[model samples]
Target: MTAYAVAHLRPAARLDDEVFEYMERIQSTFAPYGGAFLVHGTTPEVLEGQWPGGLVVIGFPTLHDARDWYESKAYQEIAPLRTRHLAGDVILVDGVAPGYDASLTAARMREAQEA
Candidate 1:
């Protein structure tokens, strides 16, 4: 299953040279782990709740790959380039399987609730 690395990053102050360097270096870190960006640094058109700062979404072949990419030495070495300057949350999440049904989950929840 595909997995994603999602980050909601807000700049601590203003983006500096270090962040730019991180951006320049980040692509190379993704190559070995089959990681690719689905979204990067785009101002979203918010229709509902508040959203501050940029969003980054990267897709991987699997959750394992996403984990590996994050733990890789090459990435770790440069992670501070971004982390030191940005405030945000990051997560790895598995994608749902093909032909999945929400009704199945609802049924399970209903059963648990009755118990």
Candidate 2:
């Protein structure tokens, strides 16, 4: 099944540049693992969490791919910046199913669109 990694970053004071650099590095590293950024720095309508910060969601071809990217040496090198910048929580979740039925999803989408 495809997997997703959701990162909630509460950037440290005055660490925007550092965070940006780290994200750049992360993006570069993701390519080899077949990962893509689904959402980066999106704000939640309801902020109920104790930690208020940036949110990043990454999609991977598989759970193993996501895990590999997270644990890779390349990512480890810049992980400190992420930790130092955000005093928040990071979570990785596996998607519900493998290989979505695009035709079905498209039909649903069209229905919703027509509605």
Instruction: Identify the candidate with maximal lDDT.
Output: 1
Q: Candidate 1 regions off by >4 Å?
A: none
lDDT of 1 at 73: 97
Q: Could you tell me every candidate's TM-score relative to the true structure?
A: 0.93, 0.74
Candidate 2 lDDT, 1-115, residue by residue in tens: 8899888767666776777788778898878999999988677565574547677899998889999998999888998877776687777788866566889989999999999
Clashing pairs in 1: none
TM-score of 2: 0.74
The window of 10 residues in a row where model 2 has the poorest summed lDDT is 44-53
Give residue 5's lDDT in candidate 2 (0 to 100). 87
- 62, model 2: CA deviation in Å? 0.9
Number of backbone collisions per candidate, in order? 0, 2
RMSD in order of candidates = 1.2, 7.8
- C-alpha lDDT values of all predictions: 0.92, 0.82
Off by over 4 Å in 2: 47-51, 98-115
